[model samples]
Target: MDVGLLLLSAAVLIGAVVLTATSGDRRIARLDRRLARVEQKLDAIAAGVGVELPEPELGHVKALLAEGKKIQAVRAYREATGADLKEAAQAIDQLGT
Candidate 1:
């Protein structure tokens, strides 16, 4: 009886751990999908113009958008670099990296 009970408890614990791991995997998959979509949009925007943007540009864009200071960032980068709006935006992003 004791052995049987112990086996049952172990099985339950293993099942719980498996479920937790699978749930984490599912969450990671969802996040990856979301990131992919965002990257697709960014690529579309960046490639529509001449200069291709780097990773830092995307990070700066994300940060400025989050802070609701995208316009300020654009202006600052433009003044500092003499780049167009799009290029300045990319420059600000470069600063992030």
Candidate 2:
């Protein structure tokens, strides 16, 4: 009975270690993807073809949308960030969801 209990405890410990290692690996992979995306954006900026506009506060946009001011929200976003009509519309659409 004592030997059985010891084997069970060892198995549980090994399982926990494997679970932790896999989770850590997943987290590292996610971070690496995010970092790569950021690097690509920076490269675009360095190439002088990137339209780096100031991002609007999402909270304010959400408030405007919640107040049922879709047009106003799009206009505010465009005016504040110098984004084109299509870009502003897309941004507002994303926020709406």
Candidate 3:
């Protein structure tokens, strides 16, 4: 009986973990979609203003920062936007503020 109860408890715990992880993934996906929409709107606005804006890599960098990955975010920003180290660092700093 004890063994059976232990197995059931483990199964419940596993189910909870899986549910939490999937929920988080879904939330991230939803946020990504929303960010894309916002980027499109920003691009349209920039076009209307006849101003050239930097690429949308900043949004991804900001998301990485929100996830507490400062170094990785900086690297990604540099890679995506082809900015030098100093520029990437400054961009990340601005986003953090």
| TM-scores of all predicted structures | 0.48, 0.48, 0.58
Stretch of 10 with least lDDT, candidate 2: 50-59
Tens-digit lDDT track of model 1 for 1-97: 9999999999999999999999999999999999889989988887888657443334444466568786887875565455688877776666556
Q: What is the lDDT for 82 in model 3?
A: 77
Query: Per-residue lDDT of 36-95 in model 2, one digit per residue for the tens?
Result: 899888978867975665555667667788999999999888887777899999989998
- For each candidate in turn, give its C-alpha RMSD to the true structure in angstroms: 10.9, 9.8, 10.5
User: What TM-score would you give candidate 2 relative to the actual structure?
Assistant: 0.48
The lDDT values for all models are 0.75, 0.87, 0.90
TM-score of 1: 0.48
Clashes of 1: 2
Clashing pairs in model 1?
Answer: 56-93, 57-93
Q: What is the lDDT of residue 59 in candidate 2?
A: 72
Best by TM-score: 3
Better candidate by lDDT, 2 or 3: 3
> Least accurate stretch of 10 residues (summed lDDT) in model 1?
53-62
Q: Which stretches of candidate 1 lie over 4 Å from their true place?
A: 48-51, 54-97
List runs of model 3 lying over 4 Å from the truth: 54-97
Q: For model 3, how does the per-residue alpha-carbon lDDT over 20-53 read when each residue is reduced to its tens digit?
A: 9999999999999998899899989989999995
* Residue 1's lDDT in candidate 3: 100
Residue 96 of model 3 has an lDDT of 91
Best by lDDT: 3
